[model samples]
Target: MSTRTAELLASIALIVFSLGLMWTVHTDGLKIGWVPERGPGSGVWPFWLSLGMALTSLWTLVRWFRRTTPESRNEAPYIESDRFGLVAISFIALTAMIFLVAIVGTYISIALFLGFYMRFVGKHSWPMTSATVLGAVISIYFLFEWQLSKYLPKGLPMFEDGFLWLDNFRWEYFM
Candidate 1:
């Protein structure tokens, strides 16, 4: 598809998605207004953000209809033939990582994704790729599981058991 057609379709999709998000937030019983003394309600930010997104999407649609934006006027293919391979590779890698999250866990999946992307796609040195993957996994573990106390998906039973053992070891020795 052409860039202009892609932009038009994207804008319309965004508008619909934003409106749906707003509606869902409103229906979840979280007040989307200022509370009496507690300040902004729980749904206030999400509702307002979605509203803003919808408004911006509407503006984009208007611009598209008027052909006022350069993207709206451009008739070039959305994905050029030269860049299609890279794009397809990236998409497939991402899909594989997401799928792996259910089998190998979030951290392992993320590490694999980073390693593959950095070493192959980015053509980075092995040391740099290893450092990046390690740092990312450690940081994510510390930030989410440690500080925020939010347990991410740990994949299958074996992986979950391994993580549980690690957590216990940390609590016993470090904490």
Candidate 2:
């Protein structure tokens, strides 16, 4: 298909996906408690993000359809040669990471992913790569696990149900 056609297809797909995501989040519930207003539920961020994505996708779709002149069409390559391999590899790595997350903790999987990505894809020096991984791991831990007093996913073996304790959706003694 032509580049403009492909762009329109992608935009439509994104709009549909974002709408689905928004529906899920709203159905999942955004508030923790009814009376006290204790905290935001797991769906809060996703709901707003999905809304924004949907709106952006809709705007792009409208613009793509309204191309009044040949000059209005984008001239840039639909998929740059330099980025094709990187994009494919990224999708593969992401799928693998999702599978790995079910077996290991999020922190461990994310830390390893960050380290490898920084070292390989970013082509950074050893010290810089290590520092980036360390910083990411530490920041995530402090924000979610320590400061917020929440538990991230530890996979099925350790956590059994694979739900984070900080979410408070389940009643685990350790939590």
Candidate 3:
């Protein structure tokens, strides 16, 4: 598909996905409370996110019709043959990452992604790359585990028992 067409469709899809998220959250008894005293309920975030996505999609549709931007002009081919291989490789890497997550878990997969991109694609020093990866994994672990009080996926059999035990402390702030 042409870049313009792809963008239009993708934005529309995002809007639809956001709407579904908002609707599901609402239907699942999550109230979109706005009062300061009551605080923002779970549905508020998804509802606002859906509204933003819908507005962006509408803007994209308008741009597609007006052809105001250079990309919307649609003069050039969508995917040049030379860049096709790079696109394919990127998708392959993403699929590999998904499998990695299934095997290792989310934090490890993210660290691997950062390491791969930083070392191979970005051509950074090993020390810098390793530090960045470590930082990212640590931050994510603390964010979900401590701040959000949520347990991320830990697929390895060795870690499963540990994670199940950790799950009990999720609401206790993981301290």
**Top model number, TM-score:** 1
For model 2, what is the alpha-carbon lDDT of residue 98? 74
Task: Identify the runs in model 3 with alpha carbons over 4 angstroms from their true place.
Answer: 35-37, 97-175
Give model 1 RMSD, 1 decimal. 5.7
Query: Considering summed lDDT, which 10 consecutive residues are worst modelled in model 2?
Result: 166-175
Off by over 4 Å in 2: 7-76, 158-175
lDDT of 3 by residue, 75-109 (tens): 46579878887787777777887888878878778
In model 1, the Cα lDDT at residue 75 comes to 98
Q: The CA-based lDDT of model 3 is what?
A: 0.78
State which candidate, 1 or 2, has the greater TM-score: 1
Tens digit per residue, CA lDDT, model 1, 1-175: 8999999999999999999999999889989998998999999999999999999999999999999999999999999989999999999999999999999999999999999999999999999999999999999999999999899999999889999998999889987
Residue 131 miss distance in model 3 (angstroms):
23
Score candidate 3 by TM-score against the native. 0.50
Q: What tens-digit string does per-residue lDDT give for candidate 2 at 1-175?
A: 3567677788899999999988877777664233356566666678778889999988887878798435239666667778888998888777777777878878768877887777888788999988888898789877887678776777766654444444454234434
Error of 1 at 143 (Å): 2.1
**Clash pairs, model 3 backbone:** none
Clash counts per candidate, in order, are 0, 1, 0
TM-score of every model versus the real structure: 0.62, 0.51, 0.50
